[model samples]
Target: MKVTSAIIAAMCLVSLNLGYGAFYVLWSIADQAAVARSEAGGGFDPSQLLPYGNVMWVLAQLLLLAILVLDVVAIVLAIATWAGRRNVGRAAPSMPTAAPGR
Candidate 1:
């Protein structure tokens, strides 16, 4: 049904928004930390790069989680729609039919 489809689309959009928000916040925090670390050390050390890498790893995991959640929602919607249609079909057979000709 159109309603179910709309709901699924909305859920996907929300998940995307969450993912974007997570990435933006995490990246900003990591950037600030890396800058501070470099400043305190008076030079950029290779070890100082770990914060960025860790942030990237966390973002990747969160993105994957978002994707998994979206997929599960879509599948549940599809199954619900299919079951709805099946129930409607089963009920249709019991309904009275008008005579072919008046």
Candidate 2:
């Protein structure tokens, strides 16, 4: 038996939401740390205080963004696929296969 469409959609949404939340939390860490360090009256550079440099932080931020985008798209595609499979079973018809009949 297959899962209900609503369940599939919900699962996708949960996965997507959690992924985005994680990405956001990871992304904010650097900015927050930088702000904390800079509050020392600008007497020192935040990058110097950081265990990781600005470049590494920014790269990590971008990587998280990329993962967020990919996961969001995967969520959408998974929901679509589940719905399609439910609406039409194996009888739904597959893409044209290479054959002499074609």
**Cα-based TM-score, every candidate:** 0.44, 0.43
Q: 5-100, model 1: which lDDT tens digit per residue?
A: 778787877778687778767876887787678678766676665546766768777876877787688779879977887898464557777999
User: Model 1: clashing residue pairs?
Assistant: none
Ten contiguous residues with the weakest lDDT in model 2: 44-53
| Model 2, position 17: C-alpha lDDT score | 67
Q: Which tens-of-lDDT digit does each residue in 4-96 have in candidate 2?
A: 875776687678668767766765785677767677674766553555556766876686677678767867887798788788745755797
lDDT of each: 0.74, 0.69
* Model 2: residue 62 alpha-carbon error in angstroms: 1.2
Q: For residue 46, what is the lDDT in candidate 1?
A: 66
Q: Which stretches in model 1 have alpha-carbon errors above 4 Å?
A: 44-102
**lDDT, candidate 2, at 22:** 78
